[model samples]
Target: MKTDTIKRVLGYTAPYRLNLIAGFVCALLYVLFTLLGPVLIGRAIDQVFGPGNVNYQGVVFYLALLAVTVLLAAAFQWVLNVCTRNVSAWAANDLRRDAFAVLNRVPLKYIDGHSHGDIISRMVNDAELVAEGLLQGLTQLLPGVATILGTLCVMAVLNPFIALVVVLVTPVSIWFAGFVARRTDGFFRAQSAAQGKLSGYINEMVAGQSIVRSFGYEQRCFEEFDKISDELYETGLKSVFYSSITNPGTRFVNAIVYAAVAVFGALSAISGSISVGQLSCFLTYANQYTKPFNEVTGVLTQMQTALASAERLFAVLDAEPETPDAPDALEPKKCEGAVRVENVAFSYTPKVPLIENFHLDVKPGQRIAIVGPTGCGKTTLINLLMRFYDVREGAIYVDGNEIRTLKRNALRGMYGMVLQETWLKNATVRENIAYGKPDATLEEITAAAKAAYAHGFIKRLPQGYDTMIEPGGGNLSAGQKQLLCIARIMLCQPEMLILDEATSSIDTRTEMLIQQAFEKLIQGRTSFVVAHRLSTIQSADVILVMNAGRIVEQGTHASLLEKGGFYANLYNSQFAVE
Candidate 1:
């Protein structure tokens, strides 16, 4: 409802304003020409049949002018359509680009709670609705309304009684359209929401098909899906039923008005109150008036549906992005990989804190291991390091300066991260490795792949380094995907590295091969390794054992075992499980 939001949408048309003006002028001329048709036909009848001096040549000339006007109207309409389509496409593209850019700026928390299908639907379906509302709606609604108004004014001048009948009929038609619109708008909104829900459910089912099959929950899933689909169908039917009534009802009203106009016009002609030509013109105008009424109801129905879509799209566009950096924030000139955490505390929600009074320091080139039970904030620590989420209390520093002081891009550029869940795009092996460093040469990409121990198998692929991956790396083993992720990180050659459960998914034999590569990669660089396998970090310079949002044990692996506390208990538990 904000004026600024509407203005912002209109701003997209600035470049095409001239063409739009021209189109509007052409439409007005076209409507005038349409109105002239009835007058010309009426005049021809008068000239041929009246007792007054007749001009057969003039009647012929009038017919010729009518033909020229019709041709001109058609030509102008074609030009208007071409211009409108080009402008509409440009505006839609710009809106899509700006929407995506805003999405990129929004915080990770916002994305975490939303469904992928719902977001995608807003981007694709809602954008198209806006385009239809702006382009097709304007072109059709404006000219149609103008034609009706112009015809009415001319008819009133020709015969007020006929004009009065049109005026009386219009309000009834408009009132009916309003009633139908009021009923259908809510139904349309509900239907769109239901569609979003259905899309989200379908995406979830497809993504989790493996888990659903393993658990034998196919019947349950099918029942739930059917319930959602039924709701969508019912809501859609309600919307359609309401919209379908409006057009026919308007046409029925127009038919009654048409009958009334004909009877009145004939009486006026019989009484000699109006000429035959004038009666003919009055009837033409009456028909023209009712035509737009019928069409307006249909346009209004489309507008209601489009408004429903626009509401969803605006909801996304209006969502506030994650906290932005201060205008005075500075970009770090250099990074040395020295990191410090001072009494850091974080909580995703208010009721529970994930990290309490956490503190750590790592000198340049030092290697540290963070070992903890599941859900003990190991990955959360890395998230803070990457600034994915800011700490609730306390500060994190890099190179003797507060991290919040540095620009986000500059701060993130210092770290190379390899996460537990490896994701690969459908691209060549070399392209996947070079994702982080797009300008990386083929030699550098191959070197990184070899360092991650992925080069050997990659060469044996159908097209060697150029081999394409299927979606989600479906054609490759889990170990291969992990190795490809590692290769991507290596290509960046970041000064600091965070490896979060990087080896947990690979077999022991493949883990050893990757570990050998990791050992070489970690040399002379500050590193933080989160691991479930205790043997993986026996030689770490410092080991921090976390539990329930607190660091319960801290020291070298040997020292922690010597203490015979929580670390020792955890080690014993893992061995017991084995």
Candidate 2:
């Protein structure tokens, strides 16, 4: 097990260390106040029942002192809780922010292999667990330890013989806690992993509901979901079972020790070896001692669960992200939208290249179309252009400078992209349209929406531009969502545009509207159009037909048909279908 994971968790609390220290000091003071109760009880016992005058005034005074002590302890506890809660909440927020920032920088490869549910679990559940650990662990450490130590010292001072018995039981309680913690930790880790799997299953099922229903796989999906849920249930039960054993077992052992201590103290008091007051104090201290031991056992068990979550969270945080920009990389200067790919080769995996020695030269304000069957590296080409993934070999240049030498942000900021699967957050229509340019005014957003042919329908909606979209834009039709995405891209006013099957899912009427919008958006920008619909790109200045990761044909529509190659065959097939 990596200890560093726990250390990193502690580091998040460094910013709030002063508050933690204040909380600790208050916890110690609270413990001191707690000790006063038993001391006052002992004094009352001596004055009222022992060989001493029954002084009512002293009794009243001690009672008043006891009440004051209780109030002060409560005050200290309240202050300690406030400090710890504030600090822990802040720490959790900071951890979440850092985790999200790291996730944004992680390579597409990492995201491709991980489910959204699993990633979300780390950000939500794991971060909350770490927060709980920070608050409860820090608050409990001082009070729990000080209570135990104060009780022990008072017991030893009041009567050494009984203190010896309490001391002997201490190690045995600790040992039991450790043994149970080890067992519970394994179960908790298994539970956390199972929870992730269950969450992933649910996310996939919801996202693919259409396919599932179309294929009549509802029963199969339920069966698979049930299997995951059952596994999670079993793992959760095991963790609960392991944790349950610690508290009862510790209490049982402490009960036996308590009985022995009571018997010994009674005999000593009767033999006149120790005063009744001292014996009473010893019993009070004995309960205090065993109380914290029991409490510690529970806290330790919880800590095991917390540590398990921390381990999983740190695993994600520690993962090496994709190659970062070089320290010497400079932000690219404004440039004409020219692009060049020189002998560029790329791959998702090292064993299989997606694009091999690909070469292309696009002049400023030129339009290029890329046509290929599904999964023939068409979208991969766009990904490389945006630096979502770096080329494995050769170089790509934007304007006249190598893309790698430009800061990734600067390189990507030059282009606007509209993907086939439009993503819209649950925000107002105006907010979604202005996503790329957050500071865009209402007039600017309206103009962009009008250009994308979305403004008319948007105005007809109940709340118009202020209407809140459902998750993934489920409130709108597929065409409407695509239009909103186009509007968002238009608002950015990028110098270059990438249309990755942006109109593939829309009807002919909607496609015509979008095509008009595309014409306006791409008028003076270098554009890359990746489409299966030959009609959409028939008028391109240059068309490249990719097959099996290489460009097998290149030309304008008329030129490509004269060559009688891949592009020619593709164009003929579409015409034949029409």
Candidate 3:
């Protein structure tokens, strides 16, 4: 693991440090009591035939001591498990929460640039991996270390020659495990990344399954999925194979340490320097000393996986958040809705300029209709006005004050937007309608829904306004969803309105009704209407025709037609086709 990643992963445990400390203490006591079992058994062995007689009482007493040690060890081990489990669960929970918060705080550009599924994988799958790994580390590692150290102390005091032999052979186990760990580390990282990509691809396919079947893309989609799945398989197999070797490799080394102790210990016993029971204790101690190495190496795979996942999680946590509001930002209670765009320039990418030298001036309460072919900066202008993307040059002003100086939330609160893409939460029809004003009463919600001509359909549902809606309004028709969105904006009654192809999904008859509803909704409010059907906006007080990121013409419907300029050509072409 990288040093930085290790520090960061450990940081999550800092908040639960007390639990970790308690776990460590329990592990220490557990190991101490466990080591006592061997010593007491050795004593009992000596007592069985003490002084050429069967010392039954002495053996029974030591056996009782052995039982006590076993019970104590198990008790401490239980406490240790509880502490470690709590620490792991809490740490993982905090890590996941922080990852989610980062997603919300990051800029929309970041969201657009990354895969949504990949982000979700980092938050869910990767976090669980870290928790599992942490749990294994705590459960095995702390006790394993304590057992190894405690065994060494007992072994050295009982017989230093055998202890020397055990110590000399221990390094071989450590070195072997370390070598295998280094080799498997890269494969583990690759495996984690491949898993994320596979998850992303699966999410995209499942969410858009309808489009896939409609276009007969199942075969191609499966091929793509197979490719990603195969990559994950290859990396996973290699990492597991390499890490799997560490356990057996250390076990082989441990067997050597045990054999050497047996050989040397028996010689001392025969030489009358040590009792048979002492020799038996030395053999057990040698095995105990090497057990930790075997157990630690056994869990190496999980630890490597955890480290890989931690790196992925940290990548998201380290992402830069959206730009902060200006220190002296204004929070206007009400905006007059007068907007001006002065010599603005912007592009999603540095190399491709999408909007350049754009200028517009609109007085408060004027209904400005924007019309252009697709990709002519109509939506881009709206995005700029909402500060979704700030201008690269010049400035935008609302009510004669530069918008950059305004708080983002306050500025956005002043405008009611209804995009062509309708989004609804998993909530009741009433709750969805009152989304803009959460505290709205039923009467107010009904009034807004009635204005959008949605009240009739809503009343026809099984539960009327209380009917539950599925996510993305999947249970509702496209037009029904759009109507709910219009009702949402109507409830807000913002100072300004932005309707971007808002009624595109409705039928002609419903569109006429909505247009009438919008006439009342937009009255006395500064509304910017982006319409492709030119007839709907003929009554607009002013029409701004855009082309290639610039306003090519602007005038009233009659005056623009008389000019026979770009606006006239566009209006004539659209109507002629209709």
Candidate 4:
């Protein structure tokens, strides 16, 4: 799994392979120039030749050469930084794009089953972690490896015995870093999961803070939040503690190796097998080689955390998208609004059936009202109609064609939906009204707003149609937001409409006006209305009463009232209490 994640993360860099290659080349050049420093300094040391016997000219030449190498190394380092930054930015942008795209493509069931906050965390925090980790790996790991290999080769040519000493001790440090990494991997994974949970909780609390404060549940909310936060803190501390061990442990081993090299090189110098200047160069190479080990070990924490984040991110990317549109999917330009459901069955969970052997048929110009208590499958039926979730056992047809055979966009485009919840983007009132008809002119938008009884209120805004709506329509009243939503559907004038308690947020007077407008709008179009307010659907051509996912009564409102069946009881119970 880790290997697959690593490959996928690297795949995001495919578009920037040139940048990666350039960065690596620059990294190698930087290492090369840096390695020259030790050699030139050693040559200058040899020119010292005790004191009076020193070759001052030779010393000056090597020092000058060392200065030039330093300058070149600095230049390459700057270029390396630029290349890595470009590559990192491109890869991050691509990864985020794919992650977000997958979210849109995946089945709605996947979204309903997951926490919105957790999903956001994966898309935002986790993706960022992966990008940062990639940047650090590119900037540090590659050059560190190059430096180690370069030092080894240089040491071998200068003094073979000291070189052998370094090679033998290298594995100890490598093994220790690997051990620490393995031990910390699970903690990092736990930390990431905990963080996602915390994020999910926070998002829920913030979005529903009004309810929290109203119910005086802030103390309980805080207690739950504290629990999740404590879990995150514990896991994060463990991951940091274990990962932090790598650098110091490896450095301690490297320190021992450094001492050994010094001792061995000193003996070789005394035996006249190596010169003082050569011994100096060997010690420098020894330190240089072990330095990469320290650097690599230090990077292990970020790399492990990134891998954990990548795993979560990949889970999202790897989810099965909505079964792709069939190869020969139909894309009808117009829908007649005729729909049929045949022997349908569905369940959110296999052990608990929700809808079974359900069926419905509607003509092109009929109005069907569905009524039920909460959790009786009114919304589920609508979800099925919209293809948000497919029936498990049967099929639905629209305009004499199986819905699955039609391109989802084409099928959904035929219907305009307004739900109880009103959603408004942070845009001008005109834009919100024209959301369903992007190219709608100002006159068209104004007509729709007037039809929904929203024009009067909109004109009162400081900038009228151009006034920017605050996020979540915080600047607007609930009734006003719903009016805008109703205006959106009024502008679209789809072949069919689904109003799921669409006017629940609006005042009764505005709702009655909107209802009158809807009466004209649905004059020749098929429409489905899900309502608890039985009075609103009195004019529906057919009323279907539902219970436990099954349609238990079917008739017009007057006929159902005469039957005194489940529909009559529901209707009577509601008004009796009122």
Candidate 5:
């Protein structure tokens, strides 16, 4: 709705100016030849009613010209469509590429807070709307404007009085279009929002169908879905109703304008101010002049909806991305993995801080185990260490260099991480293991898998290590997936490692193998292991016990057990459950 949004949409056509100009020129020439038809026909009419004998030869000559004009105009109209399509294709491609790239650059918080399905809808659905609108827009706008201007010029030249009547009547149709737009903008916007919500709900239902079935909540899920669907139906009705009325409304106004033009021109002819031939020409031009207004109005009606879609895409394109590194940002060739968190404070939202004045001093090559209850800021701490969110009150330093002053890639590249929720692309087992080190050889991949005790099960499969991983790793056992993740970190050989609830899903037998693999991988590398299972971290060089975003206790596992503090109570409780 903003002038700036319209300006930005039009600016996309600037790069294709030559194509647009050529299309406009073709459209103009087509309209010009179209206008010539009326002139030639008027001449033929005059030839039939002349003072002397009828001029059959002149009429044939004029008819031949008219036929040629029609054919030539058809060729240029084809050219116009081709040129406009080319312009629109390129602009759409540019928009899609930029819109997709914005996702990569935006802050993680944005992605976390918004629904993934709604984001996809904007990128795919709304963006497609904008593209289709651009195509329709260029086709209608350029030719429509040219035809209107050209027809008005011819009409004004032929009969100024009738042209005055047409120019005056034009505002009636314009006013109708304006009224439609005012009534339609809010509906289209609401319609788009409801559609996005429906898509998001559907996506959520599909992904969580297993939970629904397990909990006997099929009816409940359907009821929830129906609520969103009903909202979409209502909004869709309003949008369609308003948009559909535009064409008919403009057509009605156009009919009135044409009737006015005929009546006034008839009076002018009776008064002898305009000749009969000229009057015929004026009548023809009157229709020609107003038809473009009608087409333009229809296009505007369609654009009101498309502009809603464009606004969503533009919002994403304009969102604030991750914070940039300083002017003198560092990109170290290697890191020693000594991380220091100095007075860090952060929160996912305002007025509800999660971590405040948190500090840590980690020595290089030390294995630090983090143990805490759920929602006690354990994962949030790891997020901060990874620089997924910048600290508001303090700085995190890696290898004695401030992380904020280092390029994000350089800072994150030092550590290879595996979270509780494993991620495996739908690729071969070999490709999955070699994700971080893509160029690794088959022997190297096999060796890494062997270290994680995954090479045995992998080789027994139908395709051996070449077996394709299904989406969500649904084809593999949870343990097999965990081992593959471990193998990836082994191949990458990062200076630091983060294992968050890494062995939670593995069976006891596989957990032992995985822990052995972790011991080998953790050797001589600074590692942060977050776990609820106390037995897994008894051998950790240092144990950090956190609660409510601060470390309540910090020491070796044996030393903490001896002190019998909060960590002692947590350790005893877990063992009692076992």
Candidate 6:
């Protein structure tokens, strides 16, 4: 799994193979210069401390060679940094772009099932972790390993015994670092999961702040938040603790190697087997030999995290997307507003059906009002119309053609929707209104707003249409935001319309005004209105009173009232107070 994940990650560098190869070559040169410099410096020292008299010229020449090597190594190191940085940048950009594209293609059910905050975390936080890991692994880890191998080879040639000792100490460091990384990997994974849950909770809480305050739930929310925070804290501490051990564990092994090198190299010198200058060189190589261990261990723990992050990123990329358009998918040039639902069966879960054996037929330009209590699948019909979910057992038809054969975008573009909840971006008021018809002229935008009864209030703003609205329609009344949504639909002017309790947020007086606008808006167009207010649908051409996801009664409002069945009772229930 690790190799496959790493290979998949590196595959993104295919477009930058030349740069990556160049970076590796630069790294190789850097290590070569670095390893060679110590030898030349040792030779210069040997000349200075000759048996009878110092060879000053020889010392100077050796020193100069060492200086030039150092300068070249520094320059090569700079090139390595620049090349690796670009490689990582390009890789990260590709990963994030692919992840986002997958998000766009995947079924909405996937998003509904997953925690929103966790999804965001994987996209942003996990992607960043992958980038950091790549930067270190590609630039630092590669160079670090090469440095250790080169130092070991040079050291072995100088003193086989000392080289054997350094080699022996390496296993202890490797084993310890590996042990710590294994122990910490699970901790980091757990910590990431906890963070996702915490982020989800925070997101939900902030969105529902009004409800919490209105219900006096501040203390309860605080206590709940603390519990989640504490869990995250514990997991974080364990992960941090494991990462802390890698540095010290490797250092401990290095100390032992350094001590043994000093003692053995001195013994060799006294036996006249090696000179003081050679011993000095042995000491320098010993430090170089062990330094890579610390560097490698430090980054290994992070590499573990990066791998975990890569695993998450790949999971998103692998998720099943919504069924794609068939090669012969038809794009209808025009649709008459006739719609039919036949033998449709659906459920959020299997075997437990929410809407089953449901059938409906409406002629062109009819106003169909669907009324039911919450959870009775009122909004679900709209979901089906827009193809957010496919019917398990049957089909829907538009213009006498099965909708399943139509391209989803073409089918959905036939309708405009306004829900009870409004969605407004932090853009200019004009931009929000013109979102549906982006190319709409100013006159068209104003005419739509005027039709929706929103022009009066908009003109009172500091800059009218040019005024920027904060996110979620901040600084605007709920009614004002609702008006903006209605104006947006009016601008698009789709052939079929969906109004989902669209007037719920407005005042009764504004409702009366917007209803006038709705009356004008629905003319000569087939519209689906899901309403809780029975009064709003009193004049609907046909009322479908749904109960438990099944249409139990259907007739003109007056006819349903005369029948005194489920529709009459539901209609009566609301007016009982009056």
Q: lDDT values of the candidates?
A: 0.84, 0.86, 0.91, 0.91, 0.86, 0.89
Compute the lDDT of residue 266 as modeled in candidate 2.
94
Cα lDDT, model 4, residue 396:
97
Candidate 1 structure, TM-score to reference: 0.92
**Candidate 6 per-residue C-alpha lDDT over 449-493 given as tens digits, one digit per residue, 9 for 90 to 100:** 998989999999999999999877778999999999999999999
| Pairs in steric clash, model 1 | none
Q: For residues 245-362, what per-residue lDDT tens digits would candidate 5 score against the true structure?
A: 8888889988887888889988988998877777787778878877887776767656776788888888889989888777889999988889898998888887897888888999
Each prediction's RMSD to truth: 2.8, 2.1, 2.1, 1.3, 2.5, 2.1
lDDT of each residue in 347-376, candidate 4, tens digit only? 999999999999899999999999999999
| Residue pairs of candidate 4 with colliding backbone atoms | none
Mind giving the per-residue lDDT tens digits that candidate 3 earns over 1-578? 46788788879999998999999999999999988888888888887665678778988999999899999999999999999989988998999999999888887788889888898899999999999998988899889999988998888888888888888988999999989998899999999999999989998998788899999999999999999999999999999998999999999999999999999999999998888888888888888888888877888899899999999999999899878898999999878989999999999999998889988999999999999899999998999999887889999999988988999999899999999989999999999999989999999999999999999999999899999998768789999999999999988899999999999999899899999999998889899999999999999988999998988899899999999999888878876853
Q: Which regions of candidate 6 fall more than 4 Å away from where they truly are? A: 50-52
TM-scores of all predicted structures: 0.92, 0.95, 0.95, 0.98, 0.93, 0.95
* Count of clashes, each model: 0, 0, 0, 0, 0, 0
Which portions of model 4 miss their true places by more than 4 Å?
Answer: none
Candidate 6: 10-residue stretch with minimal lDDT:
42-51
Q: Model 1, residue 215: displacement in angstroms?
A: 2.7
Q: What lDDT does candidate 4 reach at residue 519?
A: 96
lDDT of 2 by residue, 67-169 (tens): 9999999999999899888888998888888888888878887788898888888888878887887777777777889898888887777778888887887
lDDT of 2 at 56: 84
User: Residue 433 error for model 3, in Å?
Assistant: 2.4
